[model samples]
Target: MIHAQTLVDAHLYPNQEAVMADALRALLHDKPQLRIELAIHRYQTEDLSLAQAAHIAGVSFDRMKALLLARNIQLRLGPADADEARKEIAEMERIIARRELP
Candidate 1:
């Protein structure tokens, strides 16, 4: 991969940060399909929220949902395991008991 410093030194960008940002932006611009695929992967892998993935792909929430549906990927927003649900419920119960005390 071409380094950001190389691009900066070549005068393609004013600074290292700008070069890196512009390179990434250009890559996404050039490969719109890749952006969508990456966003869906991030959402599916739980690396980003649906909204975040949509933003990253420069699309709307509905568009992101459509993409996911097209790929037959399930929408998972909450915990997948019973243990996590129990922990959440326990926290909620503690909060409720505290509120009832005062």
Candidate 2:
């Protein structure tokens, strides 16, 4: 079977990391629920903001919030300060620009 090394040797991808990234992109595209689960996991463990998680999961902010709530994950609420709030806004803007939300 063709593996990451095989693809790397063929120069189809620059490196194993690129191969893994493409593989993950395809897998997440084909399996959206996994993306949501991954986003939730990152959100909980990686200190990712809700908007960032939503972007990663390919879901809307509200939908992500609901998913977290359904799983009994306590929401983190608003940003701690102005800089964080700005970051959150930037993420939200990116989500909106991508039309990820309703």
In model 2, where do residues sit more than 4 Å from their true spots? 96-102
Models 1 onward score TM values of 0.57, 0.85
What lDDT tens digits, residue by residue, belong to model 2 across residues 1-94? 7799999999899999999999999999999999999999999998799878888898888999999999999999899999999988887787
Tell me the alpha-carbon RMSD of every candidate: 10.5, 2.9
**What lDDT would candidate 1 get against the real structure?**
0.76
| Candidate 1 segments whose C-alpha is farther than 4 A from its true place | 1-6, 10-18, 77-102
Model 2: how far residue 44 lies from native, Å? 0.8
